[model samples]
Target chain A: MPNLYDLAYDLEKGLRESAEFQGLKQAYDAVMADEAAKQMFDNFRQTQIVLQQKQMQGEEITEEEIEQARKTVELVQQHPQISKLMEQEQHLNTVINDVSRIITKPLEELYSENS
Target chain B: MPNLYDLAYDLEKGLRESAEFQGLKQAYDAVMADEAAKQMFDNFRQTQIVLQQKQMQGEEITEEEIEQARKTVELVQQHPQISKLMEQEQHLNTVINDVSRIITKPLEELYSENS
Candidate 1:
């Protein structure tokens, strides 16, 4: 019997392929209206490609393998704007750290002198 | 001047932190009801963590860097189910290839014999 992933994979592949083929005739409409929806669909398609490639290459599939694959894909799909946000957050965090360091410098010197 | 990623990062971080803090007070409700939406949010958060960590570690940020980061995050978020689908598609493709190989074997043999 096939597992949940196998079943889900087949279903999603069929939907995507059908959508693509329909696109050739201009019969396909947007199934997902938002960026997040689009991102999720794309991510799912990519994961399918990766799995298919691995199988074609004769990579062994194990039952014990964790399905973090879904979570990983999901995480990125759910947060379409994450990368940009991350870059900004990083810059802000750096500035915050620098300011903290600067503010603490005088206190550090005063403590040392008193000691 | 800050770039797109930097601005996007700050906005997302603010939103997430506000959401989290509101969560502590039970004032936060579901901003995204679907799995895909949740996945996109998670992916964005993870990317933010990675970028923030890199910056904290003093990794250099370059202006020339392509924002495939967003695309990657978006791809995974949008297609939250892609991984499982890929696994199934891979299995199906493998079976299809094997069947094709078997079917072609007799034709190849017949051709060889005729030659």
Candidate 2:
């Protein structure tokens, strides 16, 4: 008999085995193999995260930070590998989001006070 | 220079640190500390999973299986420890569902074809 944690472990395994996850891994590896693209992606992602954190914290994002982010995005977009990785990421996000929707269904009933 | 996989790893870490996950852990620990409760929980959860899987697979569930599941649910509900664990679980689930809603926001745009 599997415990709840065991069921969670299985879900993790299922996620790893899913096509979208595997595709994301493969695309990520492709980008990593290119030193220039990897460096560019790193810079772009760092700026993105910083800006996101700022927004989340309800802090005003300075124009300089926004411009810096825009430039970084431009650089990342110019890189073919990085662009491909982003596409793969978007595809993977769709799968992940769908999975989240399904996994949280039981909670919805409770949250909605319908059960 | 964090790659996409690093971001994914960070998300996993965040989930582990979230209140919902922590609450679930505490509830699970409490249940596990009671040998009898743990054993009963294991049996009850297994039966519930079986019935759920059968329903998902669109298979015909026998009256005996339904009766068995009802009995298991009744027993689990009558157990004080199980009831407490369920309450904790519901609380944790609310947090989890909210987290899912937030995490999937970016995907929602793509899914909705609004961007």
In order of appearance, the predictions have TM-scores of: 0.20, 0.50
| Residues A1-110 of candidate 1: C-alpha lDDT, one tens digit per residue | 22323323333333223422223212112323345644554565467677766666557645433274667555754564543333443453464344334323332542
- Model 2: per-residue lDDT, tens digit, B45-78? 7898898887765578999999999999899899
Native-referenced DockQ of model 2: 0.03
Question: What is the Å distance of residue B32 in model 2 from its true position?
Answer: 29
Estimate the TM-score for candidate 2: 0.50
Best candidate, lDDT: 2
When only the first chain is scored, the TM-scores of the models are 0.33, 0.83
Q: In candidate 1 chain A, where is summed lDDT lowest over 10 consecutive residues?
A: A20-29
Worst 10 residues of 1 chain B by lDDT: B20-29
Error of 1 at B103 (Å): 71
- CA deviation > 4 Å runs, candidate 2: B1-115
